[model samples]
Target: MSTFEFKKNIHLIKILNLKATNINELIEGLKKIPLNSVYYHTHRFLKQHQSISPEPPNDFAYWIEKALNMKKLSEIVASVNIVEFNKLWELKNKYIEVIKKNTIPYERKKKCNKNEEFVFMGCKTFIIPTGDTASNLPEFYEKLKIIESSSIYFHIFESRLRIDSQINDFQLWLNENSYSAVAEEIGKIDPYNMTVENLRRKILNIIEKHL
Candidate 1:
């Protein structure tokens, strides 16, 4: 049988030339920005706050609330379920749809200060092997407890975007190995709602039980 070679990623943040001071410009930028930029904004919190998961607000929603002071609109945008969409474009469209639908006639005219403009940022990911391979469920569970939280985040969240698949790397691997029940339980996890450390614990518990 083939072994699962664990991998980890490091993301370098790049500030794009795009910035938006008003709702109209923000929508335009959203429509045209690269999918990597979209992934960065939506998943930035998850990547940065591996130990602390908050109410789950993307950069767009945060700027709308803090900079523009659109409390209601920001709330609606923040509520975009990051886990629901597998494709980056689908997530981007949902954000544009929500923001466009919520903005009033005069809301488009609202603008923040020059310094408060929403600056678009994207990340360049470098995936490297961790040299940890698991030949079976027991080995997988043992390695899971010792790997970095970022590795957990990569396999669970970033892998979805990388493969454009609904299932994460762990789930996919498990299912491929005929561990369908374990994969299903892992799929039940909501990656956005908990810290990466907590997510690690949850996955360990599921695999440990099956072992």
Candidate 2:
């Protein structure tokens, strides 16, 4: 059999209401819609409501309520021929699991770093000569390259000079080239003084020099 001929069974499309309770039964009902119609409807739905959270319903009743609010459900039902809705249901369940597991870790990391303070420094701009020498450096060099290329001024005072030569080179280059470099270093503070708004402002000021 030809490759195309080997695939005889085509899945139908089904647009479900976010609040459907009997999801398994609903998936069965969608087996009549075409795959192409389902794909198009799903794309349109996502484009229109990109901000909707991917969380699963707490109960069947909740699913029913969500499904009712889906504006494109009818369009999906009419256009697509769905062979199986089980895969879609499984996919959504997996997404919810991932979100739940990741959310806590992300929030914890942000919270733990709340008391951290960093200084604003003048930015550096230089094209790295690409060759074998560049390839052997640590991954941190790639991050530095991105920061240098995009930033106009860096938060200098917040940064500790790990290498004396680097500090000297920066001072010499700025003076010799006559490029403006502005920086302010804030002293380290306790967690009580690390307000979120202040941190945001400091970061914005650093970014503004680059633009």
Candidate 3:
């Protein structure tokens, strides 16, 4: 059996030099921006406000509603359940579809003021080992408690997008190790609905219950 080596990621955010003052430009930027930019904008809120409620609308939804004053369209875009998306492109497409499907052709070109332009941004992600390794369930549970919240975020949120898999690192490792029942419990957790600290506690409780 192989040990699960824990890892964490650091992101260096950069301006994509893309800005949108209207719905049409926003859609064009969405289609033209790098996948990393899409990922950053979508998940930026989650990563930055780990202690806050996870219901904060994503950057696009926030800007669209606030700047463009497209409350209904913004709500529709925000309502796209990001948890269901395993890939960045999938998430991007959903946003594009929601916007296009909801708006009339003339409405698509409606513009916001110059001050309220939506600026596109991206990040360079660097993954590194945390020097934490677990060979079995007991060790896994113990490490889960002490690891940084970012590590929890990485394993649960970022890993799926990175690997282009529907399941997360913890669940994948657990299932591979014949802990399918435990993995199933983990799969039921909605990481988007709670603080990362809460997520960590929930995961620990799940693992402890089975121990």
Best by lDDT: 1
Relative to the unseen true structure, what is the Cα RMSD of model 3?
Answer: 1.7
Considering every candidate listed, which one attains the maximal TM-score?
1
Model 2 lDDT tens row, 1-211:
1110000111233433321123333333234333333233333222223234542212222222344332233233322322122244333333234323333433312211222211111122232332212111132223233343112121221111212222322233333433334222212221112232343345345435543
The per-candidate count of clashes, in order, stands at 0, 33, 0
Superposed Cα deviation of residue 48, candidate 1 (Å): 1.6
Instruction: Report the lDDT tens digits of candidate 3 across residue range 1-211.
Output: 5689999988999998889988899889999999889888888777767654544568999998888888998888878988899889988988898998999989888888878899999989999999999999999999989998889888998889878998999999999999999999999988887778889999999999999
Residues 62-178 of candidate 1 have per-residue lDDT tens digits of: 899889998899889988888899999999999899988988758888889879999999989999999888999999999999998888888999999878999999988999999
Relative to the true structure, how large is the alpha-carbon lDDT of every model?
Answer: 0.89, 0.28, 0.88
| Pairwise TM-score winner, candidates 1 and 3 | 1
Q: Which stretches of candidate 2 lie over 4 Å from their true place?
A: 1-21, 49-211
- Model 3 / residue 205 / CA error / Å: 1.5
